[model samples]
Target: MRSSGVRSASALPCKVPYRIDIADPPDDALDLLIELGALDIEQLAGGLAAILPDSVQPEAVALALRSASITVSPAQGRDNDSVWLLRTAPLRAGGILVVPPGVDAPEGSLRLADSEAFGTGHHPTTALCLEVLAEIIAEDHPSSVLDVGTGSGILALAALLLGVDKATGIDIEPAALEAAAANARLNHLGRRLRLILGGPEAVEGAWPLVVANVLTAPLIEMAPMLVRRLGHRGRLILSGISTTLEAEVRQAYRHVGVNCTASQTRDGWIVLLGQASW
Candidate 1:
């Protein structure tokens, strides 16, 4: 396990309790906890923890309490497991991410949220997509965007926030769709963001920008359908692949004439950008 620095307000206290409030916790806050290096988590009256790192300062703890309305605080240790604490941070790319205290969203413009279907913007795959999305939108605003495997609907919502006229988010998981819808509402994007509970097979019509952030196998399988759904001069972004798997995904798209020579890698994940061959 990696060690994190710990800080606190006062000197040498044997024990202390801190509170972190998350009015609306995201669906995958628990998972985020683990990803952010919370060694342990528990739901007592209310709060969460990890083993305390020596670098923590009490003043920092107090500051967190003041700023957070939805708080997660440190509690008593149990069974030889110390419970250090964590809280949520606001994500800038179109929505707020509310995870338990100590869990942080990924760096960059991507925000964090609790979602079981993944793609909450904390994942490397999602971060790469956000950066690429910004570049693509900067060149020219896309009128419509289709985000397949929409996960928490972060991609579609981000597009809508970045001036896409309308966005369609598709996911096969009902829970994912529900989470996406909730996130849309949180960002006040309910009107512009449409959440569809299905796969690429259910998507109809062409879009100027289509993004699919899913695993290698599924991406390859859906390449044909995704290619068929892009308009002339439209762009497609594929993510959720590791650098090791990039060649496979690129070759799959190449077979359908959607060449993905342009790609980005972050934290071992790859995002491929391509355009439909006319």
Candidate 2:
């Protein structure tokens, strides 16, 4: 899972009726809009822009925002699918390289078709998680792993490519599950990757390693469930959190019998590493 305070999903197709741009909002405000039901959000040059949910009107979005230098306008629909798909240069994270589907991928490279869902591997939070996973994979040599809120299935797929035998990716969104399946097929790891729709409760058993790169709030909310899903000595990687709230998230997990033994930060985002004791 990426930050709910994402810049926006303009990289993917947008059908939402109205576009709302808020100039230089407080960091938490964009996420509040998402919680209030914004869609296809794109981080604007200076602020943030998001399309109102189908049932939500621009006025409602503005009213909810309560005057934060907002501009509501009609969205200019896209004609070609290729134009909206996110196309970027190869991204390197630890031992992995994220490239567009057709581009050449050297060993340890991932051919990702960036879409509406998160986990493009470009976000600092995602990259930081991957980096930590690479190190953990090297040190622990786990055979299987679980990914919570697996967006593009990047984390799970990367684990398989790095030598994990099987991976289970769970998310609440059907669209995200679809994207993850497509990516698993794209990587030819379909046999090893399992995609499930819903949260961690939907899963049947604990895992040797679990990687969840979602935002701070969900991370905290899911702390107990995440802790319960870990094997006696399993490792946990939590990302997609702002640095400011790291303490809060760490405390949440700590209360559930987990402790942050290590952490990594990049560009105002963070990933916490912990182990389960109970």
Candidate 3:
């Protein structure tokens, strides 16, 4: 799942950018920094360096690095914009078209901009979700959809393009909501998509299809609520779960009487598809 922690980093006042230079950074070190809201990152002579927002105290970052057992030091004056180089290209996931910003979307493609918000269809979680979503549409053709934690509204918008009559997307981060709205307009699905600014609590009624591509912990916590939003015979697609957590996540939904109907895995990430017991 995309962390919302970095959503507001751009709003924080600019202060001295702290650089954390690592010699032989661990494979997961970059993931950890991204999770902790690093503003920018670059490769350096010995290894990699990340520029953290001023709001993130250096001590906190150092502690995180130590916890990961990654060797790092604060390099006081180095700055780089290479982080922005990380961009999403047009992705063909299932029958969906995921086009990055500034790139023209071909016919029937879903246009999304590169922003701090997540879900550019680059992440495996998103790709897995889109695949299952397309399968569901082809099999059941659910009339409506609700996308929880809809980062860039990619899932919801894709559902619309794939023939779902309408879709609703909810996110706790204002930046994500803003990005989703822009993406809806980009795809010309603004009228068919509704962007909400809160979690499931902000949504009303039920949907024939629902998708939540959030992490395992939050997925477990919201299991009941998400299940409740499903209409009779409705389907739920849950992703952003690691393979190790698959059973645990499935049990969470099972506890709420939702049976896992299908599953797909890619790059160690798993997506579980469920349907409420009739």
**On residues 71-186, what C-alpha lDDT tens digit does candidate 3 reach at each position?**
33333331122122323557799798787767776688888877777787767888899999999999998999999999889899999999999999998899898989999997
Please give the CA lDDT of all the candidate structures: 0.67, 0.79, 0.79
List, residue by residue over 85-161, the lDDT tens digit for candidate 1.
Answer: 23233444323333322354443233334545565454567777878987898786889999998877878877876
- Candidate 2 per-residue lDDT, tens place, 1-278, comes to 22122233244234545566787666676787878866467676888776665477555665556553666665543211211211345778878888988897686678777676788776788889899999999999998999998988989999998889999999999989999999988888899998999998998888989999887999999988888889978999999889999899989999999998799888898899998886
The candidate with the higher TM-score, 1 or 3, is: 3
- TM-score list, all predictions: 0.66, 0.70, 0.70
Clashing residue pairs, backbone N/CA/C < 3 A, model 2: 7-42, 7-43, 8-41, 8-42, 9-41
Q: How accurate is candidate 3 locally (lDDT)?
A: 0.79
Give the RMSD in angstroms, all C-alphas superposed, for model 1.
11.6
- In lDDT terms, how accurate is model 2? 0.79
Off by over 4 Å in 1: 1-48, 51-87, 91-113
